[model samples]
Target: MQTDSKTIYTPFVRAKDSVWEVMSDVLLALIPCAVISYFAYGEAPLFVMFVAVISAMVGEFIFAGIFLKKWNTLLDGSAIVTAILLAFTLAPFTPWYVVAFGSAMAVIFGKILWGGLGRNMFNPALVGREFMTVFFPLVMTSRTIWYNKDYVNFQDLNIFNFLGNGGFTEYMNSIFFKPSGAIGEYSVLLLVLGGLYLLLRRRISWHIPFGLLVTFFILLQIFAFKDIKFSLGGILLGTLFMATDMPSSASTKMGKLYYGAMIGLVAMLCLLNDVKYEYMSYSILLVNGFVIPINWVFKPKVWGENINLKERVGAGVLLTIGIVATTYALVYLHHFDLVRYLIFAYILIVIGRFSFSKQLH
Candidate 1:
């Protein structure tokens, strides 16, 4: 009966748990990643997480109390999850002010303005991260800011030194010990464990994660096979955590598959060319806007209910527009020749429309 995220039109079974309990499970899962981050990068990661969590809580308190007059909403723990997820995406040495600003934007604009929690259109944490990108591009995307004096000094203490030195060995060392990217993206092993925990807890479904990874992996093999290791950690992080967010993703079972696949496709397309910054977040936020149409297009039929042709066609049209827009945006972002993909996407849409019209009759 979770109407806010899942569709109310269908009777789907869900786990019966309070918001705080669910958020607590997510927090517990993230602990290992946080510990690994702290060990790999020193106190910088902790500082970012602390500032982000505090900023999110304070923002939730003020916004929920003043605007919604719902002071008790702060106890939900969704804000904490949003803050932590945002922190995971940032570099260890990201400025505290930037962290605070992103967290504030997440709670105030992304959550509270959308009526809090499940009512938001996009994932609140990703919204915050996107806001940071727009406002503090240098800090968010620059490799210079990713490493600090602590990290450089800590290199001498490499636990993987026992693996011995060489090209392949060093690569192995980086993957197992500390990969060079975001703070939480350091430990692929820990991230996988966290993802498995979420799966065990029923905090997430396999549909989104499986669909996303499989689609992305297959596409990477075909187009950009060499960059797989470089992108896998970040992709895993986004796939396991952000892309599976219930409120912002598709509601129906089949809808979830299509949603995940399209997210992977768009993300891979964006990454095809050389680019700075991760485009997975952009792909997620873009697909978040299409959830409504996806839900509508894939809604299950009720036994005794009458079919509404007008509504179905309307949803189809909206879905077509959404697909076209998403394709255009990805092409534009990478400065790819727009005509090629746009035309292909349009042709597919046309074929779908024709088939759909025939079925309706």
Candidate 2:
């Protein structure tokens, strides 16, 4: 007896979930952070969120109608997420008009120009933040603008000093409840909660965030041991919320590791050199531009396929050269105190790589 086989059409097996559902989950994950920001910073943060979200929705609707010829695409909820994220990156006291403009830029230039949602090469919120940083540098980095009544005095308080001064409880409370820095980055505890929620929902994988954060912590500890909180806060905000962005991050598992390591390396370079304003945003965006190439190079392996030894060797050599050259240039040009430690770190990494390669062989 012969059996007939059936093949499903284009979509194959239909997904029980939709774009709207994924976006909804992301928004839900963000709610804890949103509530914390509102309570910490008072009404300004709420207003910023409101303006940003509304502006993003309007921009998405108009742009989708004009370019995609489909207004219904706004129902996917991406625009809301973009707006909220962009707002989070902004100062709580940033003018309402600026928030609106940034939201529009995120939707029009960042998303629509790249052919809508999934096609965008960079995260729309980050693009908006970058645009503002370039054009409104003073506003974006203004100390006066960032300060609120709830702000804590972080001056002269490195992580070590904060702990040694018997202010550990105060420091922990500040990290959890006090408003400082960006509108959304105020509460490390809330951000962790939100990140955990996303992880549990399987909306995002652990690879990128894990690699980026671990690399950043290790490098930061080696270079700036006193400022552990600064590194921790940066990793929590940038890795979890920004670097793991779905559209811009690496696709393959191995690619994510490389992508995240690059992000951490670049970010450390910025931090070590005192490039204070928007360094994390810049690092992630720079890596975002390289995601396609990284994905191609670290493409997912096929089962039972032979590995290309030549390609792997060539890549290894190029990476070593890149690291050595970068370190040499930094030491030669800037002569920064951290460069010496970085050189030591690179040597250790090289040793580790060779040892691992030998074990594999």
Best by lDDT: 1
The lDDT, on a scale of 0 to 1, for candidate 2 is: 0.71
Per residue, candidate 1 scores C-alpha lDDT tens digits across 15-108 of 5788888889889988888877767677878889999999999999998888667998878798999999999998888999999999998887
Q: How close is candidate 1 to the true structure, as a TM-score?
A: 0.80
Score every model by TM-score.
0.80, 0.78
Clashes by residue pair, model 1: none
Candidate 2 matches the true fold with a TM-score of: 0.78
Tens-place lDDT digits, model 2, residues 1-361: 1121111111111258788887888898778778777666668888999999999999999977886667887898999999988888878889888788889878877777666777677778987876665556567667777766654333322333445456685676666765666777777877888888889987777888878888877887797754433535556778887888877887777778887888887777766666565568767876777775566566654566666878866875676356435544553433443433533453365346545754676
Q: How many clashing residue pairs, candidate 2?
A: 0
Candidate 2, pairs of clashing residues:
none
Structural RMSD, model 2: 11.7
